[model samples]
Target: MSTVEASAAASPQTGLRVRVQKLGTALSNMVMPNIGAFIAWGLITALFIKAGWLQGIFPALRDPDGWVAKLGGWGAYDGAGIVGPMITYLLPILIGYTGGRMIHGNRGAVVGAIATIGVVTGADVPMFMGAMIMGPLGGWAMKKLDALWDGKIRPGFEMLVDNFSAGILGMILAIFGFFGIGPIVSSFTRAAGNAVDFLVNNDLLPLTSILIEPAKVLFLNNAINHGVLTPLGTTQALETGKSILFLLEANPGPGLGILLAYMAFGRGIARASAPGAAIIQFFGGIHEIYFPYVLMKPKLIIAAILGGMTGVFVNVLFGSGLRAPAAPGSIIAVYAQTASGSFLGVTLSVFGAAAVSFAVAALLLKTDRATDEPDLAAATAEMEAMKGKKSSVASALVGAGRGGTISTIVFACDAGMGSSAMGASVLRRKIQKAGFGDVTVTNSAISNLSDTYDLVVSHRDLTARARQKTPSAAHVSVEDFMGSPRYDEIVEQLKQANADSTPAPAAPATEDAPVGDADVLPVSAIVLNGTGSTAAQAIDEAGALLVAAGAVEPSYVGAMHEREGSVSTYMGNGLAIPHGTNEAKTAIRRTGISFVRYPQPIDWNGKPAEFVVGIAGAGNDHMALLTRIAHVFLDKDRVAQLRAATTAEEIQAVLNAGE
Candidate 1:
């Protein structure tokens, strides 16, 4: 289970925290994709602005008549430069388009851009906050309005109706954005900028490290930096030419100090791993490389807090700040974005933070050496658990991989009722087909896991928790339970292991099992050259096919969207299996599956999906044919044929060919 999942099971407050984190994740998603644009603007500011590098190198460039001054948007040239317009117009529009695309699709993106322009024109300040609001609003409003006339539009008039409806909605949203949202967000932005200035003026800004250091260890660094700090910092930078807000979470010193301390005072695997980790943490700017070291000695968080405070204090004393956010917290990135005269201050801040954290961490490590020694493996596991995904750098610290003969394999998930059950059914069939009768496969919730199993397979997000439960078992993590490539790897490993031993008898062949009132998937349900304007539209098409086959009610289609809203159904390898949520089981009239192959991939939650499989399973009735379909997809050559197929019959034949 993930930290969010575990927390929700514990208390309501933690559940609320999870919801807040989700919101942060959503906000971060909007900004992360646009970081490149921010970088471009920063580069321009550092190189061409009035107080920039070129002016320092050649003083004449600072004059109003100089070409450099004209390019820099300074002196008599005013706001004519690319730097001002890019941040004011280009960046926010990109963010708005991305946000709208996330909410709906291409149409939503177009409407979102239109609405964002209104806010841009209305607000004096850069309207980043306004774009974040209006973009999604435009997409959502368009979606709701379209639903009213869905299926009610006549055939040939579809294009006419869609174009006019979208144009009208965009115009209305744009007007609302200009008059209402622009001013509201502008006020919010100014207030936030004022708060940061107050913190800086009072010399109390370093205190923020107390919350920041702890949050970074918990894997909320990206959220805090990109979602909250970047937007606020951008506004501050516009007014003052630099912003200290960007350095708070992006400082690499605190993490570097902890790793250096581990190298000097730590023992065993942690000591051996610390040197390489230090390089990655400091130079590569992957701050996560040192999180396990802190997790091993949680008191080291104090070291981090103190180090952060020291760095902030040094920067404040020097009145130094970055022109833009230095992503990945790398020293190289930090230097790249530093203001023209702030090099000394930035350098000292890193060294000071490193010195403080290293001293504190060394003291903790040396004193605790006798009594604790700190279990590196256990701490690494805890770090991965907190991160909600495996950390390759942390894994290297423990040297965790081991090889042995496997007899029993277990599949685990949070509830073990949905994903785990399906995964277990699929893997069991593979093992049986391989004639490995001695190998026993089962499914269980992570809470019920036992250490007795020889192997445990789980989703990557849940693997850390499963490891805690079954520490002795060799673990394999996968993303998709339906058709993971890992399952095939496991089969291959098992086959190789028994190469020198007596061969087990092959299982007898049986006719493919029946599913629902008809076959698992019928020919008429398979659509070649499948058309969908968006992910949601694609899902609706698949659901419509299922409904046509009498396998599910229309309500099941809505349930599929509900499920997607909570957790995306995107499986890897260009395939996405759209299914109703567990609660929507009643919507299933009988077991059924529908296949739609898109010649051109549609964006399924930012991932390209060429194949969409809509599934409505009634009990275990569909597992057999589902397994066969999964295997067909597992084969790259078969998938290639399906992708190239011209007719629905060709696609159907390719799917059944594996059987």
Candidate 2:
């Protein structure tokens, strides 16, 4: 989540901070997801450009004397011929598409792209910053015109009006971008470039990290990369064959160091997931993955700043630079982009930054693991909850009780394309399968959320921002986009509500009876007053119950442990639903759920758990059962009754009541 979304509830005095964060989120949203394109462009520029390793491999490439030179010259020729035009032509359109989509979806994207070409054509320098500004402005204008025309245009003239209006508006913006905005933006770019050049000449480049690290933590990495560094780096690379400006903000050393520290000293989910995150950060070139870790501990920004400064200082001392921008900020990409003589220097700078950051983070984490455990657990819970379910059927029912019916559902995130898009697609599929074909599902950036959506689903981290953006829309939060069990509960609720209001005819009974009392969860699976002090112990006892009932193999218990290691199974309200990982599917004999109640609450990571439910399913067949179980636990009355039950028979009766 962006700092703007995280600080939605901040005081009025922090308005500047909020605005800065919003700008960061918008700019980053435009560039981060498209890092792949940047990386591809970077590789092309680094491998085939005149100053690249191709010339080093074939020294005769620069000589105009022989046929060998002709073959070797192809690299530089292709680099300038193909890669240069890509940056000049395609980069602006990409920026425009992203910015326009953030404001008004596909229609806005079209107008934004059209308008951006005018700026790109008119300017000598790359018009990236101009695209960022004009793209959204054009999209917003189109959105306004669209809203104005809604319900007003005659049915037969709809296409005619839309086509004419869009064409006229686009043409006008293109002209304005060329004659009006282009000159002003170009002048500013020239001034900024001169200023940056002066800073680099004076050897004060490392000091820029004071601003860059904080802005990066707030999701301004993309804006800094494309809007500032890429333009400057391109100019420098053209003149000197390489530029240190590219590495200034794209370094992954600091983030990698912080993750390593977490792996060593952090508790709970942070420790467990840090190793995998480290590998992705260093190899995948995705620096955004570590933003949440920094956000969870804002004070850690100091470590990032110090580490970034150290890396820059080393680069300056070694006179190291890259042939092109290192997209995704991965170490491998950095090496790939490094100039021939700068490889050792760049490598040293990277590891140097990592070492500094690790030291600072380790000191902050300290030796007292117990003292930090609770905070780590809370952070882990918050992170997981962002991908977990946000709303219950009871809450949705309350909203529906007020005469509301969900006609539209919008999945929102910091950027529209990442998790929200995936979640929206998955939910749309499920909604269609559940027969709610009339309900429209879409995805958008959190900033673009509007009251038109009847339901807004987003990460829990963005719930406050979502509510602020679309107060009338019912909100749902989830941690994982692809595997949220909450979608099933939501579908069932909507189906039931639709059935109640539509007066549909009763359908014939089907063989699949929704996994209720008739199918599984007999009294034998219930264990009351179970003996367990820790979450793992409680889960083990529950899994044993499932194993004894022939619901799963003993390997299923290890799978449960493995899943918990990745993310806590704690479902809030003193309940935990432990299940095996996907890899453990072979251990399942059938779909079954076993419940064990611990009279004494056990610490499920940082959350307290009094009830442990072990789940084993052959496939997705248990999803319905999981949904029913969620509903049962979500109800205060049902949970209270289950807690008060004395015997396995009484627990069974409560479970049956929930069904």
Give the number of the best model, judged by lDDT. Answer: 1
lDDT of 1 by residue, 27-101 (tens): 677777888888889999888888889889988677886788777788778889878998899988988887787
Clashing pairs in 2: 285-328, 386-478, 386-479, 387-478, 387-479, 387-480, 388-478, 388-479
lDDT of 2 by residue, 456-545 (tens): 777665665776787666566665444577788768767765665553233322233243363467678888888887666776898898
Root-mean-square deviation per candidate: 11.4, 19.5
Considering only N, C-alpha and C atoms within 3 Å, which residue pairs clash in candidate 1? none
Candidate 1 — worst ten consecutive residues by lDDT sum? 3-12
**Per-model TM-score versus the true fold:** 0.68, 0.55
Q: Which stretches of candidate 2 lie over 4 Å from their true place?
A: 1-10, 13-15, 63-80, 151-159, 220-223, 265-273, 288-299, 367-374, 381-659
Cα shift from native, residue 16, model 1 (Å): 2.5
